[model samples]
Target chain A: MTPIDKNSNMPPESEAAAELLDTQLDAALQSYTVDAPSDLLAARILKMAKATPQQKQTFQDIETGNIRQENVLWREKRYGFGIAALLLISLTFAFGTLNFAPSDTESDTAEIWLEAAADLGMSDIYDWVEGQTNSMDDTR
Target chain B: MIYKADPDQDVLTGLMSGDERALKELMRRHLDRIHRTAMRILGDAALAEDVAQTVFLKTWEMAPNWVSGKARLLSWMLRVTTRQCLDILKKKAPIYTDDMPDISDTSDLADKKMIKDDSAKMVRKAIERLPNRQKIALTLSYYENVSQRDGAEIMDITVGAYEALLVRARKTLKNTLIRDAEISTERPKDDRKLAL
Candidate 1:
C-alpha cells in the first residue's frame, strides 16, 4: 500500500488505500458500543434540578446585573479611599497652620525686665567707668 | 408567516413555569443520547453520570431564558457535555490502558468472542489516546452522527477545523492500530509457547 501524503492530494492508488483504511477504522470504531444509562440517571438529574432555581430574569438582565454589581462595588471602594485621603489632607493642613512663635505677653515681660535693670543704675556703672578712665589718663 | 412550532417549546414553557413534568418530558427525549455521549468521551461510568446530571441541571436553569429558535436543545446539551468532559480530562489523566484485556494471546484456545472483545478494546484504547479535541470530534461525528455544521457549533469551531480534526483523529487511530498489529505479529515465539 502506498503511503498517504499528510499534506498533498492523494493519488488514485493512495485514495483507494485511504478509503479502505477509513472503512476499517469506522468498523472498528463502531465495534465499541455503550449500553444505555441506568434508570437512576434521569431521576438523579430531576432531583438535582428540582433543588435548583431556574432563571427568572431575561438573559440580558442577568448579564447586565452582574457587570453592574461589580462596577458598583468598585465605585464604592474608590469613594471610600477618596474620603480617607481628604480627611488626611485636612488634618495635615490644620496642624501646619498652628503658630509656634513666642506670645506678645512674653516679649513685653522681657522688655520690662530690661527697663528695670536700667532703672537700677545700669547707666551709673558706665559713668564710673568713664571717670576711672579720665583718672588713669591724668596719672600718665 | 408559517411558524413551525418547535416540539420542545411547550415543555420548555412548562419548565420555565416550574413544572416537574416538563422536566421529565425533556429527560425522556434526550437523556440517553446525553449520557451515551458523556460515557464515550469520559470512558468512566461514574464521571459520565456526573456530566449527564450537570448538563440536565444546567438545562433546567437556563429554561426560562431559552430562546425558542436560537439553538436546538440537544445541540446545547451536547455542547455542555463536551465542555464538561474536557474539564474532567484536564484535571485527571484518563487511564485508558488499565485493566485492558491482553490482546497478544493469539493461541488456538482463544475464542471468537474474546478476540472480538479484544479488538473493540484496542480500538477504544487508541481513541482514548487521541488529543481531547480529536477525541471529541471523532466521538461526535462517528458515534453521535452529528453533522459537521452541528459539530462545529458544538465545538465552537469552524466547519473546516472540525473536519480537519476528524481527519487527523482517524489518521492517528489508523496508524496506531497498524503499529499495534505489527508489534503483535513480531511477538517472540516463546511468549506464544508460554501462553499455550
Candidate 2:
C-alpha cells in the first residue's frame, strides 16, 4: 500500500489529527526494537524440526497432507473407543432381561397362600391329578 | 550436514534427523527474544521464563515442518508467546506498574543506552492500560515492526481490524501521553522525583 497523504484535500481537521498521530507513532517506534533475539531463529527452526515428524523433513509436501490425516485419525480413535463402549453398555441393558420381586410382597403372600390352601389341599389335588393323568395319558 | 545450503536450515534439518546439538543452537537463537516478549506481555520474570520454555518446547515439537514460508518463524514464535501471555493475562488480569528492564529513553543511538531504566517500565505500564486489542496492535507495530499482514496473522485478526486497532491504540496512547505531560508540568521536579 502507498503511504497515506495527510495533506491532500483530506478534511483539514482530520488531516491535522492524522499528522499529529503519525508523529507520536514515529517517536514510539523509534524508542522500541522488536528484537527477535538474534539467536532465536536457528533455535526456533531447530526446535520446530525436532518437534516435527522425521517424515516431514524427508517429505515436506507429503507431510503437509498427512498432518491433517494424523489429526483426523487421532480424533477417530478417541471417539471410536468412546462410541464402542457406549454401544456395549446400551446392548447389555437392552438384551439382559432381569426379574425382581419385593421381599415384603413375597413373604406376605407366602403365608396367606399357605393358610388358604390348607383346607383345599391344592398340592394333594395336583399330585392326584398328575397320577390319574399319567395312567390315562397314552390313550388320550 | 543436513540439507547443507543454509546453516539455520541445516541445523533444523539436523534436528529433524535427530541431531541433538541442533536443538541447542536453536534454543540459543530465540531464547532471549522469546523471554523478552514473554516478560513484556506477562510482566513477571518467572512466568516469562515459563512462556519462553513452552514456546521453545512447541517449536522443538514442530521442527520437521518448519518449512521456510509457511510462516515467518520468529513472528510465529512471538505469536505463540503472545498467546501464552494473553492466556495468563486472562486468568490473572495482571496490572503492570513497574518499568521494563533495559528500556532506554534516549532516541540518539550514540547516547549510552540506559540499563534497567524506569521510562520503558512506565511506557509498558501505560501500554498495559490500553484495551487488549489495542495493546496487541501497539506492541506488534511498535515493538515487533511486523507489517500489517504479519501483525494480523499474529493477532489472528483481519488486516482491516488490525489497522483499526492500531489507529485506536495510537490515539489512546497519544491522549495518555498528553495527559501525562500536562500532569508532569504541574508537578515540581522534586515532587516528580519523590513520586518515582
Candidate 3:
C-alpha cells in the first residue's frame, strides 16, 4: 500500500471506488422510501386529538386533586359516624345506671319495707287485737 | 424545496386554530397512512390501529410546535412514526413475519412515483427486524429523506453512530430480502395497484 502524506489535498484513487459505493448506497436508501405513508397522516392525527379530551381531563381530576378531596370527605364522614355511635352508647349506659339500677339494689328495697312498718303504729295495733280477742271469747 | 402546505399541515393548523371541521378532515386524510405505517412496523392490523391512534394523538399535541419552515409535515410525521415504532421496540420483543402486505400499484402514475410492490413489503419486514436505533435511523433516512445529521438529531445519537446504524440496518435488510426471494418463488402479485 502506498502511504499518502496527511497534508495532501487530493485523496488516492480509492476515492473513486468510494464514490461508486456512495451511489449504490443512495439507490438502496431510495428504494426504502417507496412506502412512506405521507398521504394518510392527517386524518389519523386529528382523530387522536379528539379522542381523549374529556376523558383525559376526567382522569387527571381523579388521579390528582379531586381524588384527595374525595378521600378526605370520606374519612371525615366515617369518623363522624364512629364518634356519634360512641357517644350514644356512653349516654345510654349513664342514663340506665341512674334511672333503673337503684331500684334493683337490696338496701333500697329494705328501706321501703321499714317505712311501711312504721306507718302501722304499735299502740293502735295492740288495742285492735284485744277488742277482737274479747269478741271471739264471748261467741265461743 | 418549498414545503407544500399538505392537507396534514392544513388540518393541523386548522385543529390548532380550533376548527371542528378540520378535525374530521384530518382523520379522513391520514387514517390509511397511519394504518399502513403501523401495519408495517407491528405486522398486525389491530396493533397497527393502536399505534396509529397513539401517533395521531401525539401529533395533535405536537402540531403547535411544527412551523412550516423547519421541515415538511410529511417528514415530521415520518419522524413521529419512526419514533413511535422505536418506543414499541423498547417495550416488547421483536416481531417476525414470513410475508408482508402488497404495495399499491402505480402503473398509471408518473415515472418518478415511489416504488411499491412485494419488494417494498419485504423491505419493511427486514427494516422491522433491525435493532431499534438502526431501524429508526434507516426509516428516517429513507422514508423521510432526512439527512444523516438531521436523523441523528431526531434520534438523539451522534452522526457517526447513526451512520453505523444505517450500515448495519441495510446489511441486515439486504440479507433477509435475498433469503426470502430465494425461498418464495410463487409469491402473489397485488392486482389493485394503479386503481388506488
Candidate 4:
C-alpha cells in the first residue's frame, strides 16, 4: 500500500483507483447495447409524413397567409356594416313616408275651400266629382 | 484538394422539392442512430420509435427552408432526440425507479451465460437509476461516442457543465454497482470485475 500524503487531496493510489473505475465504466458502457430498430419504423415514418401536411417553410409565407386572412375578415366586416346601414336608412324612410299626417294649416285651407264651394252652390262641380269617383270605382 | 460535395446537401435539395425518395434516403442514413440514441435514453423501444418518427417529420417540414453549413443535420436530430427523451423522463419520473424489471431473459441458460446476462442487466439498471440529465450525458459521451463539445451543444449546456454531469453520472453508477455487488451473493468475482 502507498503512503497517504496529508497535503494533497488525491494520493497516487486513489488516482490509480479512479482510473481503474473509469476503465470499468467504459467497458460496461461498451458492452451495454440495445437491439436495432425495427424494419417497419422507417416505413411507418414515411407513411406518416405522406399523410400529414407540411408547414409553411419561410416566415414570409406564413406572414403572407396571415395578411390574406386578415384582409378577408376586414372585407367581410365592411360589407356587413354597409348592408346594415343601408337597411336602417331604408326602414327609416319607409316608416316616415307611410306614417305621414296632414298638418293643421293644410286642414284649415281645405275647410275654407269647402265652405267657399258651398257658398257658391257648385252643384256641377259636385256632380262632376261624383261622376269621376264612380268611374274610378267602376274601373276598379 | 478534391472538393467532395456533401451528399446531405443533395438530399436537402430533394426534400425541399417534396421528394419522397429523398425522405426515404434520409431515413435510411440516420434512422438507426436516432432510434438507438432514443432507446438508450428512454429504455422503451416503442417510445423510441415514436420519437424517431417525430424527429424525421420535423425534418421534412423544415427542410424547405433549411440553411446549409450552420450545423450538421444529424447533430440537430440528436439534440431533438435528447430533448424528447428528457420530456418523457420528466413526465414519468416515478415509473423509472431502480426496482424496474430486468431487460434480459435468463430462462434455461447455461451458468456462464446467465452470469454474463446478469452482469449486463445490473449495469443497465444502474444506468437507468441515474437522473435524466446524467443519463443523457453518459449515453452521449460513452455509448454514442459523441465528443464533449458536441454533447454540450446537444444538451444546450456549457462544456464544463456537461463534463460535470458526466463525472457525476459515472461516480453514481460506480457506487450503485459496488453496492449491488456487496448485496448480491450470486455475482461472480470475475463478472463483478468486468461490470464495475
Candidate 5:
C-alpha cells in the first residue's frame, strides 16, 4: 500500500503489531479474490445500456433507416439513368439502320459534287445557275 | 461537460445522456469489486455473475434519478449488490456449500500444497457455514476491502452494529474451524475429494 508513511516516525512496537495484523489478515484472505467479474462484463453491460429506456435513439438506429432510404434513392437514380441510356442507344441504332447517320454528309456532298461537275462542263452553266435562282425566287 | 476528475459523476452524466462508453467505463471501474462481493456472499460463480449484471442494469435504470453527494456511487453499488445477494439467499432454502470455489492452493511441493489447501478448505467451509448476516459482513469488510463505516452504510446499520457483526462472524468462524480440526484429528480422511 503506499510505503507505510516513512516520515510519520511511528514506534517500532506499533509497527510490529501492525505488521502482525497485516500478516494475519493476509493469511485469512489468501483464498478470497477480488477478481470474480467476467472479462466481458463491461461489454455486456454496455450492450444492455443500449436497451435502457433512457437511450432515445442510438446511431445504429438512425443510420439503418437512413441507409435504406439512401439505397432506394440510389436505386431509383440508377434505374432512371439506365433506361435513359438504353433509349438513347436504341434511338442511335434506329437512326443508323434508317441510313440517316450517313445520309447527311454523303448525300449532300454527292449532290454538291454532281452539280459542280456539271457546271465545270461550261455548257450554259451560268444560264442554268441564273435560271435556278429565278425559279427559286418565283417559287418563294 | 463532465469533468474528468470526478469519474462517478462523469459516468452518471453519461448514463443520463445515454452514453454507453460512460457505462462501460463505470462497469470497468466497479464491476470487479461488486461481483467479488456477490461471489463471496453467494459462493456461486453463475449466480454472482447474474447478480453483478442485474446490479448494473438496475444502476443504469436508476442513473437518471441518482442524486450525487447523498452517497458515494460505490457505496450505493455495495448496498444494491448486498441486497440482491441477500434476496437470492432468502429465496433459496439453504446456501449451497457446493458452490464454493476450491480456493485451495495447489503448489508443486506436496507438503506446502497439502497445508495450504487444508487451511483454505477449512476456512472456506467455516465461512460458508456462517449465518447470512455474519457471512455478508465478513465478505464485505474482509474480502471486499470495504471500510467498517462504509460497510455499515451498505448494510444499512450503525457502525457499532457492523463491528459487532464482524466480531460475531470471526468468533463463529474460529469455533467452526476448531471443531473441524478436532473432528479431523480423531477421524480418517482422503485427499481425493469429489467437488460435490
Candidate 6:
C-alpha cells in the first residue's frame, strides 16, 4: 500500500500539530523506564524456577497470586469440569444399560458401597474417603 | 564466569537447559527495555511491575518450546508485556486516573526542571486519554521504537492496521493537546531545549 500521506495535503496547522506530538511522545517514551521493582522481577522468577523442579512445577504451585497464571488455571478448571461431567454421563449410561448393577438411589448406593467395603476388609477405606483423622501417617 | 559464545543466540537454549547465568544475562540485557515499554504504555508504575513479572515468568515457562530464529526473544517478551497491559486496561474500564508521578525539582535549574516536568506530565496525560488500541500502537511504535511490522505483529494486526492506528493515535493526541492548550504552538524548539 502507498503510504497514507503521499497524495493528500494536510492543512499546515494539522501537520504542525502532528509534528509537535511526535516530538512530545518521543520525549515521553525516552524518559519513561520501568524500574519500579527495586530488583528486576526476572531475578525473583529465576529464583522460583531454581527452587521448583521442572516436572513438579504444577499449576497450583506456580499460579498462587499471579494474575496471568490464574487465568490459565481458570481455563484448566473449566476444561477439567467438562471432562468430569462427560465421564459421569458416560458412566451413568453404561451402568444403567449394561446391567452392571440394578438401579439404586443415593442411600441404596451408599449402603452397597459400605457392604462391599466390609466384604473386602476395606471398611477403613470408607473412613478414609470420609476424611478421617487417623494415624496413617505413622504407618507410612 | 564460564565462557559461552553468542549470548543472544543461545540464551533461550541455555535457559531451557537450566542455566542460571543465561537467565541472569538475559535479564541484565533486556529487562530495563521491556519494563520501560510496560511502564510507558500502562502509565502505572505498580501495574507495570506486575506485568514485567508475568512476562518473564511466561518466558521461563515457554523457553523450552521457543523455536529459535522464529522470533527475537525481546520482541516476544514485549509482545507478552503489551498483551498483559491491554488485559489490565480492559479490566479497569479505561479510567486512567491522573496520578502522575511526583516531579523532583532537584534535577536541573528550577525553571528548566519545572518546564520539563510539566511537559512530561502533559504528554503522559495526553497518552492516557487515548483509546486502548491507539495507546498500544503509540507505545509500541513511537515509544518503544519497535518497527511498525513488529508492532503490528505484537498487536496481532496487519501492518496496514498498525500504520492506521499510529496515524489515528497521532491525530487524536494532536487535537487533544491543542484543544487543551497543553502543547506549544510556538515554533518547534531545538533538541537540547526539549524537556524529555
For candidate 1, what TM-score does chain B get against the true chain B? 0.80
RMSD (CA, Å), each prediction: 9.9, 12.4, 15.4, 12.1, 20.9, 18.3
TM-score of 3: 0.44
- Candidate 2 reaches a DockQ of 0.13
Winner by TM-score: 1
- B25 in model 1: Cα distance from truth in Å? 1.1
Candidate 6 per-residue lDDT, tens place, A1-140, comes to 11112112345568774565566545544553335455847667688767754332434545564335547878899899999999999999988887866556667787888788699999777678656445655566
CAPRI accuracy category, model 5: incorrect
Backbone clashes in model 5, listed as residue pairs: none
**Candidate with better TM-score, 3 vs 4:** 4
Q: Sort the candidates on DockQ, descending order.
A: 1, 4, 5, 2, 6, 3
- lDDT, model 2, position A8: 28
TM-score of candidate 6 relative to the true fold: 0.56
True contacts reproduced, candidate 5:
0.37
Q: What does the lDDT come to for candidate 4?
A: 0.75
Model 6, C-alpha of A93: deviation from truth (Å): 17
Q: Deviation in angstroms for B191 in model 6?
A: 35
- Tens-place lDDT per residue, model 1, B1-196, is 1224666787888988879999999989888888889888888888988998999899898787887777777788899999999999978775433233334434332332233337776676667767788889999999999999989999999999999988878877877666455444434444555354
Chain B of candidate 3 achieves a TM-score of 0.58
lDDT (tens digit, per residue) of candidate 4 on A72-101: 888889999999999999999999987895
C-alpha-based local distance difference test score of model 2: 0.61
Candidate 1 lDDT by residue in tens digits, A56-140: 7667776776543556888899899999999999998878766554466668787897688779968788688889999999999
Candidate 2 stretches with Cα past 4 Å from truth are A1-14, A32-140, B1-8, B43-46, B64-69, B94-121, B187-196
Candidate 6 lDDT, B87-176, residue by residue in tens: 998798555432323232222333333443355665666677777888888888876788998888887889998999888787676555
Give the top-scoring candidate (DockQ).
1
Over A1-140, each residue of candidate 3 has an lDDT whose tens digit, in order, gives 11111222124367764454445445544544433344445554555566644222234455566554547888889999999999999999999888876454468787776567667665577678889999999999
**Segments of candidate 5 deviating more than 4 angstroms:** A1-26, A55-140, B1-7, B94-116, B189-196
Residue B141 in candidate 5, Cα distance off native in Å:
1.2
